[model samples]
Target: MFGLPRPVKRLIVGAPVRADGQELDLDVQLLLLMTRLENGDLAARTVERARRGLERGQIYLDRRPSRPVRTRDVDAGGVPARLYTPQGLPPGSPLLVYYHGGGWVVGGIDTHDTVCRYLAVHAEVRTLSVGYRLAPEHRYPAAADDALAAYEFAVTGAEKLGADPEAVAVGGDSAGGNLAAVVGALAARRPAFALLLYPATDMTVRRRSRELFADRFYLTDRAMTWYADHYCPDRARRAEPAASPLLADLREFPPTYLVTAGFDPLRDEGEAFAARLADAGVPVAARRQADLVHGFANMWPLGGRFVEALAEAAGALRTGLYAGPRGRGTTGGGR
Candidate 1:
């Protein structure tokens, strides 16, 4: 499958799939089929195996052309991080402190290099991708602690990193998104804005989307349970605001752009968080990509609706970070 040409891959992923009143994007459907064929069920695999598989899979999926961004390793308050600055970006530009989406066990900075680079170039902002310690080794509150530390580092060290101290943002996909939301809620100095893609907000409750699009999608129910078990072994602690940002106090959250995939199991909870943010008077933009699935942010290399969707997100990030304060209301309209 990796040897197939772009056209061949496109042709293979051209068939559409409809279920639960949502039509899955053709490319996403194809990716799902490939995932099923390659690895049966994520929960069935050992953590080591799953981590290896994700690293290998990224080599094929993250084939987007490299951007002319200058990258360097940095220590984000003791956590490993990579900083991506677009070539020609001026000093004092906006920065995004990023987190990768790997269920807190699988992915790392290398796996999400393309994502940070893409956002750096397209959003015209510097990106600092944090590599927080994984779970079952450094569990529950570990990732969250690292995330807060990293955000603080980004804010305090913005000037040295060639970023505007007042324009720093926080963002991530899935697990990363959860961290970003948590930071937005709990940080002493809040980010200027937030960009979350299909975030896992309420881990404690299995929303309808969880049961409706549980299996066959990139993120499965069993896989979620597996991740939660590894990250926060104490089931009782999953309800804590640190683990479930949807339950966090959002009264002082920064302006946010939250996007959800219609076919993603985490869809409902992500939207619910967005609604909560708006209710708290935080300016927010919420979008639902009606035809996409989970992990679409990493699928931009496929270059079709995937790139289009991500480009829209980049546009929103650029605007949110560069524009003036937005009104407090939910803005929703997505393909």
Candidate 2:
């Protein structure tokens, strides 16, 4: 179970219901429409809508304030990734390497750019977002390999970027969350932390939430199956920790922040992974966005609460990482 200590009470989350979820979450409604399109068995149109629905974050990223950061094209597991660094970093500053959520098929740096920027500035750390190749082209373990390469780059090549190689943290949302967990498993307690946002830990389709929320939840069973199928063409490979870290026995994971959406089908899996972490004696803190849906981190344009949720999550990150060096200074506040 997720232990709550003091402030954790204020940060606790509640589960979301369908009817009340309708008000004030139009993007979710639109996304639900797009998801239904995905479930209609129309591959071309569904993928097209998925692409567009994923782009809805553009409005937020566009309006987000930009800062001075170098974009260096780097290689990761044969995939290309663009690294971002804030202006004028003194040596030994911490670094955060991130992966974007697209359920393994859709997103890249472009989709997750603004959120990355806010994280870089807010956490007071250099944040690098990975541009791993998507599925239906590059399948399972491909993204994980890219994540490891990016992690290696951050750890081994820190001097060139003016960051502490030892202080790097791995994080991501959705499928990226899976990558983060598996990366931590591979790194074996090297990075300072692992921040996961509604990670898909199990590629298995038989989960209770997946069955119960087959269509009603913002993310449905059919869409999840679509993503898993695209990423895991080889049925046997799906059992690997890279594809499903929740099934893999992991020990000595880094200190972790596992965030989940209460209404998400992936919620149970993320929570389960956190429990496994603690059971394995890995330091962990799990936060569930009870009132939010999956991918609410990208809901900046939805309203103030959405942005506040991001702030809260980032604040938790800062608290978990920099609790001593600095005290609770928030960045990325312009809404």
Candidate 3:
């Protein structure tokens, strides 16, 4: 199915899917169906198999070659990371330390390369895509620890990475977003900004969206539970601020731009966190992509609404990093 031509894929997608008062993007519906046909029952797959499947799926969906961004392998603190710098970008530009989403287990640098490239090119900022340790192997707090270390590295070693030390930011999608929120709250020095995409903010409780879009949305509830069990087997510990940053104090968090998909299981929690940040007097802008699903960041190459949504996020990222402080509020738009 993934091997089909773009037009052919659209033909197969047939019609948009409507559920719970919103219509899912046709491209997203097609991708979810293909994923189901390609890899059935994600929770039943072995960890290695799940990782490979996610990487393969991302590569297939995001087929656009690298843009004008120049990339280099670098060590962020002790964590391996890839640094992307857009062509002709001047030194001392802002830097975004990014983490990839895979429920803390499946994704890596290769899986999220296209996303970083898009941000580097569109947002016009230096991007360091962190390759953090995975779970069920490294387990709880390992990824979080690496996330903070990488952010510190980006701050302290910004000159070496060709970025402005004071303008360093943290951003990521899904589980990576959780890490970004954790780093935002726990970092010794606050980041200049934060970009969280459909973050898994609170792992301790399943919000309504979790139950509403539990299946057929690219990210299933069973798979989420599987991920949580592997990443943090101690159920009680899931409530820790490191594991569930939504519960953390946000008064000192940096200005943030958070985007959530209307159909994603993590949607409600991400919005809830944004509301908490605003109530804490932090500057925040939250947007809901009403016609999308989880993992839309990797689907931008599909064009149409996917690209439009991501482009909005890129614009917000640019503004957050370059426009200085902004107002705090919740805003909604999509489709």
Candidate 4:
């Protein structure tokens, strides 16, 4: 669909992959090529430069009109947030508090506006996209603090924003996913569910995937190390469960859906966290996009595969947050 040559398509789908799963999808390969050609090493760029670069790259996606949903900017309990509401949504539909991914440094609401709009429309839920303070300025625990505050705001102030407090969920991608994990654990009352897409659950130590896919995937290990350094300059804070949620007590977490990418450097840690959540008696839906790398969720140019993954995530949101409670278990693309 991305106009990949037939031979390149065959090579992409046929390439031998890591022990975790299958080869890269042709669409992802094409997107990676385009990304490599267009962007520079993010790790080497200043935060402002990196942010501008990402925002500029974001312009390539077809900026679909949000006719089906209405968007507004608002203060989410002292944190700046953008709210997206599906047009004509019934009373008491589920509400999702979303966090954007950028290694806790670069991205903000504008960078992830499309993702929030997609969820609001496809999931038929209202979404609040938080623009938490960034790293190297706000540093360790600032974003976590903002996440907890935003969730609390959504839960307590849902009615004011035309949503149901009891139906509120929390989610994010990469660094934002890590924040969701932390918030899901520390919140006074558990959320309906947490949708984590290729999350960075553990920053305490490097996992096998980090070493194996260090430079092969879209998100390189070097960039990750740089991100971690900027976010949590103190190594001790990095080990804290609030910072590295994979080390947290997952027993009390609500229904959780974790989406990991087979080619992502963070894959193993995300899967391990899912296993830990299941082990701790939390209902889980874990899926691994064996043919995609980290951040595929935002690479709209890749087409249907990424859209299908988002649909799966939306389905998980509907099933987990809307259905009645049950025993701990998991179902999806992974164990």
**Local distance difference test, each candidate:** 0.87, 0.71, 0.87, 0.83
Global lDDT of model 2: 0.71
Which is better, 2 or 3, measured by TM-score?
3
Please give the distance, in angstroms, between residue 108's alpha carbon in candidate 3 and its true position after superposition.
Answer: 0.4
Q: Which 10-residue span in candidate 3 carries the lowest summed lDDT?
A: 326-335
Tens-digit per-residue lDDT, 1-335, candidate 4:
36667686656555544455477776776667666776655576677887787788788764543456778998988999999987777666778999999999988998888888877776777899999999989998999999999999999999988887887899999999999999998899899889999999998878888987888567899999889989998997888988999999888997899999988899999999999999999988899988888887677534668888877887788677656363223321110
lDDT of 1: 0.87
Off by over 4 Å in 3: 1-11, 65-67, 326-335
- What TM-score goes with each of the models? 0.92, 0.81, 0.92, 0.92
Model 2 residue 319 lDDT score = 66
Tens-place lDDT digits, model 3, residues 114-133: 99998888887899999999
lDDT of 2 by residue, 154-213 (tens): 788876766766677888999888898888887644677888888999775466666655
User: How much does candidate 4 score in TM-score?
Assistant: 0.92
Which sections of candidate 2 miss by over 4 Å?
Answer: 1-49, 56-61, 66-70, 87-89, 324-335
Q: Mind giving the per-residue lDDT tens digits that candidate 1 earns over 6-44?
A: 678668876568877888866677778888778646564
> Candidate 2, residue 289: CA error in Å?
0.7
